[model samples]
Target: MDTASLKKEIIAYSKTIGIDKIGFASPSTFEEMKVRLYRQQELRYQSGFEEKDIEKRTEPSLIFDKPKSIISIALAYPSKMGPKVISKKGERRGIFSRASWGTDYHTVLRDRLKKLEEYIALKMPEARFKSMVDTGELVDRAVAERAGIGWSGKNCSIITPEFGSYVYLGEMITNIPFEPDHPMEDRCGSCNKCVDVCPTGALVQGGQLNAQKCIAFVTQTKGFLAEEFREKLGNRLYGCDTCQTVCPENKGKDFHFHTEMEPNPEIAKPLLKPLLSISNREFKEKFGHVSGSWRGKKPIQRNAIIALAHYRDETAIPELITVMKDDPRPVLRGTAAWALGKIGGQDALEALQHAFSVEKDEEVLQEIRKGLYFFAEKKQG
Candidate 1:
């Protein structure tokens, strides 16, 4: 079997199955990445979501037996929503980042990888393969960079020449000796736009991120948002796209190649007040198909309350009061209390004062105090 011919066939087959870009890489130990992983660990900069084993993450051989090459694939998602849902006064909305605009990308990428695997298996019956999306042990960006998919951008995303940094990456490890593609040059050069625009200053430096400070990571946390980052969240409900949106490389880079990748404006940018009262079943029914819903409604709802605060929407005050007074989750209740304080008015202050007197939870009481402080500040001013 001619390995070179087989690689060419796989590339051609990939295009037919909706893979936007494909590249092959040698399955060598990612020595440089291993160093960075250790540094991230030492600095406590890692998001708890990543696979814990650094060896498995960097050494393909540790996860897949006799791996000869890694096939990196990228699928571009839309940067712009088709029919914009205007977030006007009295009807403010929260936004999921562009990455969560469509059907869960994990499902889309996994389907594409499975098809590629099936095609390769049929051609070479003995080829052993292992594949993974974002949740997998292998770092998708590192694999893509090595496979010539793109360069690792300043914002810690794979910036493909064709799709900028708005691409979803997946990889397959196999015992096939395909010729490796060369990695792309660091086109980011002196551009620090992504770092400059990161709301939380999550981009510690070029190609490095302190995930704890990233609004994208913070939005997914199922807890009371820290007071410092609350205002920075703006109306983002799930992830933060400030870094990508500010990237000059991503300028004019929007693609609608796959129907599944399209955003439903209503779901992607839904009314914030409606989100405050949404039932579990209602939340699941509407947002379950999107990747942003994976953390479930708790984080999204918490962020929604903060978004309401960001807009200082007087109309959402009633819903925020209800959440503050009756929500089962302490995080939501506390977040609602804070939102009430931020969206201060006579009614909002009255509700916070009432909650402070009756709320049993210690954390909730503290939030209620924080809420009342806004009124105190207003009086002093």
Candidate 2:
């Protein structure tokens, strides 16, 4: 059978195995992406989590031997939860972004890619294939754009007409010389909503991001969040979706095709107070399966403290004091001290004063001073 016929069969089989969209591209070097990546590096705008080797990221031939074509796949995820966990006065909940809604996309997309590989192997026994999800050296969005799966959105996401920007992307590099799909035309003309609504001005322009200022990146860091970004974080525990949510193309684009991708409201948006004292074992039992939990409980817990402060939830003051006093991690202790000041009252003031006297870490001491300053400002007001 010719490669064209096999490509058609693969596309058909993909839908059967829960793959929503698939496109093929020439496995040539991503010349344009290489330039942008170098510029991003020069500006120091890259998130540290990304693959550092730009050559491996842009050159498919470096990672895959004898690469002839690349196949890009996308699976749409739900934008809204089914049963919402409402955030009220005392029971305020912190949210994980829609990307971290259900089971990890890495696991789900890899499963689909594995099935596709096995099917292709049966058809062409000599076909060689290498597959990868988000963490792979090859940039998934660039490949998806090249393969006509979607146009790269202003928000730096691949925006498929069918699923908008709420899609998980994966790719497979193969030795089979398949006809590549036509690339999609840019549809984000004259739209700057994503940039305008970015909480931290992280969207430097249409397609570029300063990852250091991005709340999505900030929430993943295991340190005291910069004072300026804490309030911007709002109630987000894992990732920020402001850019995607504000994009006009993503409006009303919610798809729940895979059951495994469906979110449990309680887990995706859990009460913030319970998280303050959750043991490592309990956190794993509850959030272990989700992609947001990949960085462990520290970032989440720290963000939850910031969220409580954002709400000015006086009820959480007791919990924040406990975290400040007893939590071993200085980031959490320092953040909780700052939060206590943000949620000022007699209790919070006393706690901050006590922490100031007892806290040994200079960073924690600095936070206690910041907390005390809030009270002084309030008194002058």
Candidate 3:
């Protein structure tokens, strides 16, 4: 088995599989990353992650055994794709963040990487290797930078010259002695577009990010949002792409290329009315393939209400009033009340008053009364 010949074939195979970039690095390149993970854990940034993530990420053996090289792969995520017509009365711009505009990358990349592994094994039957995506222990973005896949931007996302920061990263750890690639130079010089445009103030100075305050992370988080952060959520139902959209690297890029990944017309830009009234089974059938569907229908439905409230879309008020009374999830009921307040109309106010009278939970009833007060006050003024 000629190891050199196999290495060359692997790279060629990866490109053929649709990966935009591939590079190599020594496993030792991630020493600093292990330390930073500990610091982030102490600071409570990774509270949701199990302790195993912290432990395994630091294990040199876990990523590779007697490893001599690392391979990092990048897949270009189409950042723009949506409808052409805009309604003058209600334009809910149902744009997909570059990452979501295609079939989910997890399956696509995994299938490719697994094939690459099989190729390597055939060439060197005794070789050792493992592959992983975003779900892995080792910080994918950090390894990506070391492998020269791209530079870590101020937004803390991996950015390539061709794909900007709108790309997904995956990796393979192997014991083969392949030559590592050079890293990309930092091109984000004097650029603060991503930070300046953030609605949640999650990005700090020097390119550090606090995920707790990130709108993307918050939207995906389970349970209800705090009162203070509710209104700031705006009309974002799933993930927030505000920071990435404003990036200079992503700006002016052509969108006419490939954008077939946009959601179904009705599903892509969901109607507030239907979202507020759907059964759990219907929600699953519609959004099951998308990232937003993972946390189940409750959080998204809750976010839809929040977004409706922020947009002040009074047209959705009738449905909002309906959900306010019958939503199985208390969180959804609470958020619907808030939306009714924001979209105050005579019918919405009356619904809130009725809810307040029947509401048993103090916290939920408080939210209902809050909505009623605002609706009544708006009518008076």
TM-score, one value per model: 0.99, 0.99, 0.91
* Candidate 2 per-residue lDDT over residues 216-251, each given as its tens digit: 999999988888899799999999999999988988
Model 2 — which ten-residue stretch has the worst lDDT? 223-232
RMSD per model, one decimal: 0.8, 0.6, 2.5
Worst 10 residues of 3 by lDDT: 87-96
Candidate numbers sorted by TM-score from highest down = 2, 1, 3
Go through the candidates in order and give each one's C-alpha lDDT.
0.93, 0.95, 0.73
Backbone clash pairs for candidate 2 read: none
Better of 2 and 3 by lDDT: 2
Q: Which predicted model would earn the best lDDT?
A: 2
Candidate 2 Cα misplacement greater than 4 A, ranges: none
Question: Model 3 off-target regions past 4 Å?
Answer: 47-52, 85-96, 254-265, 376-381
110-226 per-residue lDDT for model 1 (tens digits): 999999999999999999999999999999999999999999999999999999999999999999999999999999999999998888888999989999999989998998888
Residue-wise C-alpha lDDT for candidate 3, range 155-233, written one tens digit per residue = 8898888878877788888888887778789999998888887887888653677778877778777677987668677
